[model samples]
Target: MSSLSMASRNLRRRKARTILTVSGIVVGVALIMVLLALTEGTATQTNGLIREILPAQVTIVNATTPTGSGAGIRALFSSGYNLNQSTVAEIAGLGGVYAATGQLSSTAYLNGQTVLLAGIDPSSYPLATNGLSIQSGTSLSTAPSDQVVISDTLAGQLSISVGSRVTLGPNSTGGAPYTVVGTFSSSTTFLDRSVYIPLSNAQGIAGEQGKVSEVYVKVVPQENASTVAAEIQDKVAGVRVVTSTNIATAVSSLTGTLTTVFAVIGFVALLAGGFGVANTMIMSVAERTREIGTLKAIGARSSQVLKIFIGEAFLIGVVGGAAGVAIGAATSLLLSSLGGGAGAGGLGRGARLFSGVLAPAITPELVLLSLALGIGVGVVAGIYPAWRASRMDPAEALRHV
Candidate 1:
């Protein structure tokens, strides 16, 4: 019989032991697959959200000297820079500029719950390009005074609908009452938790009349975004100009780190599983000592003996990896489905984290990598045992009890 067939027959003869070895591999491979699926899903969702929110646009924020070394620290404490209507006008007038608008933001209590309040010039807002779709009622127009547009998620949280009046600010006492004129839908998690009002109203409420927190600029088609960004930086001094590519890169870096952390965890599990396989193979070599000696005496070369053992290990890896993939995929899907509704209670930070991982994305690379990992573990685990079987002294092994 062929080496592969012989290896198959040997494993069949010890079905219980073989199954146990395969089970260990299955568990490890399954864990790896699950972790990879979640990591990939999270990265994909985050990148997509970033692109949806900041596509083809440049964001300008107040520039500040870094008080600390890290970007995070600088972002957290940056102050003293503001964008006014004149800056917005100048950016709009720049060559290759499609649209420019300024936004004012603040934290306010809405219907007894704190929510992100964003003020934008309705006439200049890039609604369509920014992926904000009005799901119900009329959008804020130039006539906006007390009219507001809220996200579907915010609507659910506050139990308010279009035409529903809601109180804003601290205990609903800080700003004039506003009427909900529209509800918008956005795929982004953060944006979905925000309420939008006319820039004039927002400025009035925040006591920052004639000032905006940031400016968003959209470049005309067929123009280089980087070039425009540099120009904007030169023209608009005392502000930070961030292009869409910069935002995407930052998002990608964050997700890449998260993926690496989970990958390390999965690798550790797989390493443990490799040890289990090695132990099982070593025991198998001991049990088959006599058989190996007889085969060598009967014309089986050392190479053939090694192939037999490696083939057996490889078969185990194949079976275990396939089974693990199926189980892992099912488990991930189930968990994602359950986690998708976690934001129903509120749009708090915890809810956003959970809601972001709404589904596990299974990619071809993930499947192939999982299969390769399992087989690689099996092959590495079998090496010493296979070598031991191949070097067995025929005369001595034949006398093994």
Candidate 2:
């Protein structure tokens, strides 16, 4: 029989101990797989969302101001920054710019529940020209001043439909009542929970007439976005210009940090699994001393003995790693599904944060890397025991009890 076959038989001789050791490796590998899936999945989802929402667009925010003498103590608050209709007109007139729109945003209460409110010039907004479509009722262009459009998700939450009058702001006494002229659907999550009204109406309600929180610019198709962004920055004072790519990069960096933190935790579990493997191998060596002596006497070299032990460890790793991958992938899918359901139902803020857009994604690279790590752990853990077995004096091993 071959050394590897012999090793396999020996492992089968102690089924319970072998199972316990393999379980340790399985747990370690599963932890690593889950961590990688969550981090990578979140990054991919965030980037996709950024592309969908901000594609070929430049977002301009209020610029930062120095707050202290220290290098990193500058205050980047845009609390007082406000854009007006003239600014949007100026952006539209700039070279390489196709269109511009102003947005006014604030928080307001609807039927005792807080909701996001956004004011936009529907004609100039990119969503109006893109994938946004009214599912019921008419567009903002024909809607009256007291009428507003809302997302289907938000409408469901409030149990209100088209032609329904919803009170906005504090309450009936302090809030302004508006008719739901339309319900719209889009590919973005944020938009799905938002209420859209005419720019003038939002400004009047927020008591910030003629003022806007931000401006969205769509550059000409043939122009480089970065070049247009730079030109906008040069032309517009006290505003920060950022491209869609920058948003994606920022999100990726955040996810990368989270991945690193979780990976360290997974590493700790793997170390524990490695120790379990080493302990099992050491015990196996002790139990098989007499067998080693017989093999040596029958012409098995020191290298051959070493290979037998290492091969046994490698087999355990292969089995354990495969099982772990299956379990981890299933767990990730279950968690993501649950989270997505909760978010779609408008359960809570935390639940919505991890809903459909942040589901775990299992990639082939993660599986291969995790499997290799498991095998590597087993090989490293087996080294000392294999070395001890190979170094035993044949006569002494033969005399072992």
Candidate 3:
């Protein structure tokens, strides 16, 4: 019989133990696959959202905060100091500037739940943001009316619709009621959580009258966005300007940290599986000492004996890796399905936002990588045990029996 055939027969002799060892490897590989899938999904979605949401060429904020540190609207408004509304006109008048708009942002309470609020000028907001996509009812009219537009995501969360009367303020008390004029869809959970009202009302609510939280600027088609952003930074001494590149880098930094952390955890689990494989191989070699001596006495070379043990380890790795991939893929699909139900009631706002956007991506490269890991671990773990079995003296091994 060939060395591989002998190895296969030997493994079948202890089927239960071989299965237990393979199961350890499967657990580790599956865990790594799941982590990679989640990170890949998040990175893909975030890149697409960055392009869709921040179409403006340049965004201006107070210089006190770091550039690109607050790429999201909520972070930008909450951290930066206010700039006077006149700054909008100054930026608009600059060379290569097509238009500019000021926005006021603040936190408001709605039925005891914290809500993000933004005040925008209907005419100018359209010029800067290209206007909100209204799913139902009409967007805010040009006049500063006491009407509010909500994000469809928030509307679903609050269980309110257009023409629904709701009250919002800095606190739970003494707030005026406004009618929901429309619901808009921004296609991202981050921006979709905000409630929009006239800029005048937002300014009044935020208590920063005559000042705006951030400025969005549209550059002329013929001009370079980088050049315009640089000019704005040089001329406007108290403002920080950020372009698309800066925002993308900032967002990547946040997700990159999470990816690194998860990768480390997965690797550690794989190492533990390796140790289990090594232990199992050692015990198998010890139990088979007499059989190995008989093979050597019957004219089998040491090299052949070594191949028999290593082949067994190779088989275990193949089976474990294949099983791990299937289990990991199935688990990722389950998570994606659960995540899709984010709009359902009973979840907290933070949980809803994360689940709403989370999608686990299982790519072919990820599956191959996970398989390679399992095989590599098994081979490395078996080396010592296989070597000890090969170098054994026939006389000593026969005595051991």
The deviation in Å at residue 284 for candidate 2 is 1.8
Candidate 2 per-residue lDDT over residues 178-277, each given as its tens digit: 8898898755554566788888887777777887776777766745768988999998887777676766665556556667876887788788888999
TM-score of 3: 0.77
Question: In model 1, which residue pairs have backbone atoms overlapping below 3 Å?
Answer: none
Candidate 1 lowest-lDDT run of ten: 69-78
Cα lDDT tens digits for candidate 1, 1-401: 78778878888888998888888777778878978887778767766655555533677777663323224212421223556757888887888788888887665677767676778888888631463579998788777588888998789777899999988763455556889999997555656667888888777767778988777787766366688888999987787787666755665565566567767876787787788789988999999899999999998999999999998888878877887788778877876766565553233444554446444788999988888888888889989999999999999999998
Question: lDDT per model, in order?
Answer: 0.74, 0.74, 0.79
In model 2, what is the error at residue 49, expressed in angstroms?
Answer: 2.7
Candidate 3 residue lDDT tens string, 1-401: 78778877877888898888888888878878887888888778766655555646688888875434333433464724888999999998899888899988777876556777888988898888657889989999998788999989788888999999998777878687889999998686556568889998988888888888788888777357889999999998799887777766766666567567767876787788788888998999999899888888888889888888888887778778888888888987988777655552224443444553356799999999889888888888888898889988998898886
After superposition, the stretches of candidate 1 with alpha carbons farther than 4 Å from their true spots are 1-28, 52-56, 65-81, 127-131, 173-175, 268-272, 295-307, 323-347, 350-360, 387-393
